[model samples]
Target chain A: MKRSSISSFSNPAVIAELAAHLHRNNVASIHIEAADGELKLVAPVGASLQTTHRATPVLISASQPGSLLAKAPTAGIFAAAHPLRPEREISTGSAVAKGDIVAFVKVGPVLVPVIAEKAGKVVSVTSETGTLVGYGTSLFTAKT
Target chain B: MIHVLGCGPLNTIQDLGRAGYRNIGVTATGAMDPIALKVGNLLVGNDEDAAGIEIQTFPFRIEFEQAQVFALTGADCAARLDGQDLPPWWCIRAEPGQVLELSTPMKSARAYLCLQGGIDVPLVMGSRSTSLRGSFGGHEGRPLAVGDILPVMAGTTISPPVNGFGIVPPAQAMPNLFPVSDTGDLILRAIPAGEHDLFGDDSERFWSQTWKITSQSDRTGYRLSGAPLQLSAPVELRSYGIIPGIVQVPPGGEPIIQMSDANTAGGYPKMAGVIDGDLWRLGQARIGSKISFRQSSLTEALAVERAIDAYIDDIRRTLPLVANALVAMTKR
Candidate 1:
């Protein structure tokens, strides 16, 4: 396949710039392709295609649970449960608050904690600390 | 029996792959490209998810202890059995002591080799896929090795190869296996998520404008390099549910997009997600490529779903014919 580069943002500093540009340009069809292992977005037409889009969440089980959730907003080292140093134990049905420091990450000098939401039995502790993580990646499971 | 002569960096038994285990913390560890697996199986009259061999980027040799019909697919490797060329996506009868070979990846990472009758490997969680990180399923949950004796069941009774080779995956249905872009940066269309306002306009601009992918990408997520992932509401928000391709920004300013094996929950501020269709691209991204993100409306994003469904519908159309042929063969 032919190789190419695509830059969606003009400023390349914040996504808002792209969002603003998208709103202004009204991007219709965004063509994101990978050339040479890189992903590029190529959509000359802006915003007009909204008419062809769909609306709905790919929900499973229930619409959602009423219980609060604890999560990692970004990627980093997960500290609680993991393959090597997994979180083997947690208090059963304990009421934990959000940002309760249930786990910690060592990204540079920042040691962020994997927190807890209003807790129940620690349903599960997913990955381990120092394991490469991603944004919106989870670390704990508290069934409320 | 199909015997392994020499395994490369990684090679393992894979079937349709493990599913429904994400909620229980297990990845759907299976062949990276399901379509290729199907092509190989179709040629050999094996179940698409049947136990077979997955060849990694590197190449190796395997010896069949008995003559068996088999096919290889994915990566377009130059395969040879006893110095004779082997056709991809086509079934062939190999004689015992024949040294089957896979030379190199033509345009992809993994490839599949399926015997006429599927190999009857024990299943784990209803699959025979290998989990590299966890190292627990599919042929001992690890790559293959030399001198390993693999069991192969009798080829299922099926129509002649004439009817099989007549089938071809539409060109569009073929996976990109290896992406053709070098921009390392992953462009994902996303919906504004929690903390959308917290980062305010200025930071969002940075997210959209200046960023490249870090060398730190894998099956989990891609890390962005640029201004610190700052938020307008800098206050820490409680964590919540996260999905593959979900873009989350931390205090450092880099936005990471989750992948197929991403965790189910998180604590960082989510700005948006890499659109679902583009997600598979995440699987092929090489490290240190440039990356960018765009906001997509719910309606626009669903367009991706519809597009994908059309592709699936095409595959579904062919299955009935194959299944019918199998039924007739069994009756005979």
Candidate 2:
């Protein structure tokens, strides 16, 4: 099977596969952007497809008022917790302080922490564990 | 510099090890878990062969005399920096006067602490590793003690994230490569040695039965207890060169796997030699743990080595990128 990239989202087959993966993994949403365009897919609770749109790429999005996102600093795999640690660093409704590591982006053998820019309560963890994430991909949505 | 506040005997400084002098009867004494030491060194931007502290006995406590960047790898010792819990396989900067404590690990054996500049122990026989038997290398050629002050080599300073970062431990990252028995015994891959066929049926038994690591085990070798392995016929043999991981069965019919501090030569009947790539896992195996052997080929052994090399290469290539990205992000 061919690997999917941001550019491949224009293909219907790739989009369908990605949506199926999102539903299978129970992911809340995925927002991807490249120089050419952007693709946003939101799978609501128990729903396969709630919203799918193509819009101007916004590097950082404040989906909810006063809610900040912890974005991926580089492109890599998303890990909710350090692979060696049994406990997740942050989850929905968890309180986090500024500079707290809410998640990690694993670029091959290296693990880069996704730090919370501001102290807030995590409203949602947008990225699925073990999924590929791009630079500026929202990992956690937190409200001050 | 760092001051050893509390420590147990046998914790010493080690690099990759002193090589080539084994023929002259000098044992190659190095960190039991060499992979951990290498990874720890790399994490702190040191050469892979840079010297570091190998802590097997704990609780080890030290006070950093100056602000230093360090990395801790290997066994999850539940380390704490000034009362803050640090993750295993992690690297961070320790402020001057900050205390770092490491408790006994719940699982696995040995933990490594590598500083940005590496340990400044005088190299004897071309390595910083302590030759406990020879008593000439490392921090005065003996294990560290309380009040011992060790110097650090000067190196270029590189900033890590405030809280530091960690890599996925090799055991967790490459679980499928090494096999574990159904009963939770470690399965080590080995190649048949010079006298393997001499044991006849016992050689097969050696591969089949699970052996328990006896308490007599040390850095020199592991004395395994299992069903006594006997040879088809008794034969006299001349002493021959030996290396780490050589499984030899003495007249007592028990197997002893030579380790990092292995003797230069031995006269015992050889059964098999564990692959070098899996020696790190054996190094981490605790006394009383069970282990089994799986016959492997040279091809398979090289494959395992390549896999390990790939892991290290990945870390070397990505660490700087991640660090640079984090620095850029924080500056924004």
Candidate 3:
């Protein structure tokens, strides 16, 4: 995970190669030093002509809202209504009181009902039935 | 020592990678899945990135020519050793006559097999890596086929110590995992490069809307197609050097992800590049998978770089020093 640095070079060939990677990754500043004092090949910002510039950054921002969902903290299959009966409205964001049956999921073979946390508008649903969803997949979201 | 079964297409010997040879157009061709290699190596007390077998899409079955400790990583292949199931990411000292079989993987696309001493192949151009494009390094620049028996270098100071089996720790020491698959949203953060301003705003926005990886994906590059971006005018640029993350957009307006073994120079217009740490995840992507792009600031990208460095430091701290010291000596 070290900041992999490429040896600085003034050769047009080497400069172009390094630039393309740095530019695509958006590496704004490139450190350049040469023993011969014969350094060149510098380009203006947004110089889209050279292969030497590439952007390389990833920024995580709070602007983009991410939802955290609660699950059984275990395993089970999912259902909208009670087992051995007809299914009903299971749309995400459906309102339900505390302790109301929100969905049922089967772990291995046994079916278990998942209770609602607090009353809220559903934001997003995570999985489909028997989809082999992992421990992290977001199940139907409830927006408070 | 062992008898290689099938080296799979494009399979060959590899080490940590070939480095410091960009002056001569030589690439640091190493394992596509470094996390797996690190784990397998750790299981057997071998230094990370030691030479091993890289099986892309496997049913790899190797007959043990000698008793040795071995481990598997990368893909969730149904590893059956002598007709018995074997646990993944754990080291096992096998009997001399044991034959290990790994069925085609179900979870991942590539599989890495790390042995106590590692697969010994001749070092060429300062590495044991195979660069087929140059047709030189590694087992004659080819995959080991049936009846190909690689003789392990005699008198290696074995690390896992013959009976060194114990509770293997987690493959990575930290939780900064480079995700293998994009959960339905195959998006990558990139900065505009050589051709950032060529396309009109509408066309550029359309690119992020719907683009799919064409079936023509390969080790050399990944071609994506959907709609063409309108350019201000057709400008011709001279050929220039290239890198793995470079994205080249042709006159037809198709974008391609240049990968390892990519040409050192190219003529087409370059677009954007996948982040370095994220590029490794590309190794596990299935063909025809959807890929999306997001623009990020250079400042943010550099921050991502720092976090990665910190994560690596955590893993390196727990590494057994025996192999690292020995490997360092040979590298010097």
Candidate 4:
């Protein structure tokens, strides 16, 4: 098939020069393969704006269809460990059983333990330590 | 009963001063800071006027002869129970063998350790307070010494083990309670006494200048260093009854404020009287520290007294709730 859009740039020298310019600008892919083909270019999003879509859900794991997301049980300051034992932190891949204190939330001077709901390996810690978190905010992702 | 392992030279057992006895000749030798004694008593669930140990020296050591619930108030003495640090103004349970060591206070001049009940010394003249001059009451009318074992009152109720709370001293809880000087001098509120006019210009100077607390001050009286206050003339005055807080300017240029152990009567020209509410600040005043006078009224003094009462009432009301809450939390 032939078209005027691609035909206008039919010269091999002009086409090569256009491709070189696009490549220098870090464009990922370009298509002008056919005489009638519309020119198209794609570039990876900048690192600062890597994830621009809000509706894209994060998958905890590919192998597990129902990977567990550990959420805050109550609204308070999310602490990775007890306030008294601040040096201790919940490590990723650490095994936790049901009712085990995987993390804590500090309410004033009192520490409230966040118990695990199911036996699992911590896939990732989602909440930053000492940050105020609301109820149901993701604290960790675990694979049971 | 508790055994004194070590104590400062001035440590003694005290309660609220002996009431209705100044008519005789007995000085009401009691805790310099009566509010501290009262608060410590309340923390441990005792009568506000319960006799307790008043520690003025550093490294005061005591061993519990029996399991008891006790509270420490007043100064932050850096207390340690068997090497573990104890919070000031806190109530804690002590096992029979636990030794509590109270070092010199970091910010105050005295500390009060009160047991669950009042001290069990024989009440003389209807009070358990020590009469240092009469040598009649409170652990044989002498300061507590090593090897001196004080028996706590029998059947004194032991508070719950979970009871743990502290109170900020009234003077510290509100900055406005006792006005502090810019130079850090403790400015005590005083009411001009009967002889205040006798000093004339010196009276004005007394209210304006900062007076240094001299080393000669003791429980009986605080000798102050300032301009020599002179009477309008050398007048012979009859010996009259005096109470704590009376500022007596004696021979020479210094002023003297009577304390908990002061003589019941005096003949010195009294320029002012430190109000009952602010005497505790003078109690905590260390030697070499400076003090200023703030002229106050009786109505204002009564208000400060009410404020202190309200503070104690708050602690009394909130402590049980806190204890119950702590117990519930621990069980979960």
TM-score of each: 0.54, 0.86, 0.60, 0.70
Order of all candidates by lDDT, from best down to worst? 2, 4, 3, 1
Model 2 TM-score (2 dp): 0.86
Per TM-score, what order, best first?
2, 4, 3, 1
Top lDDT hit? 2
* lDDT for each residue of candidate 4 in A1-144, tens digit (9 for 90 to 100): 235554354232343455456546755444444433343323232212233422222232234323554655433456786333345567687887775557755333223456567888888786677565443445776887
Question: For model 1, what is the alpha-carbon lDDT of residue A140?
Answer: 57
Q: Candidate 3, B253: how far from true, in Å?
A: 1.9
Q: lDDT score of model 2?
A: 0.83
Better candidate number, 2 or 4, judged by TM-score: 2
Clashes of 4: 2
Q: Residue by residue across B81-167, what tens digits does model 2's lDDT show?
A: 998878789999999999999999988888999999999988888999998888889999899999999999987555788988888
- Candidate 3, residue B96: the lDDT equals 90
Residue range with the least summed lDDT across 10 consecutive positions in model 4 chain A: A53-62
In angstroms, the error of model 4 at A6 is 70
Please compute DockQ, using alpha carbons, for every candidate against the native two-chain complex. 0.01, 0.25, 0.01, 0.01
TM-score of chain A of each: 0.43, 0.57, 0.44, 0.50
Write down the lDDT of every candidate, Cα atoms only.
0.56, 0.83, 0.58, 0.73
**Model 1, span B194-266: residue lDDT tens:** 6777777755685458467676765556787777657756676675766777778877777887764466567
| Runs of candidate 4 exceeding 4 Å displacement | A1-144, B154-163
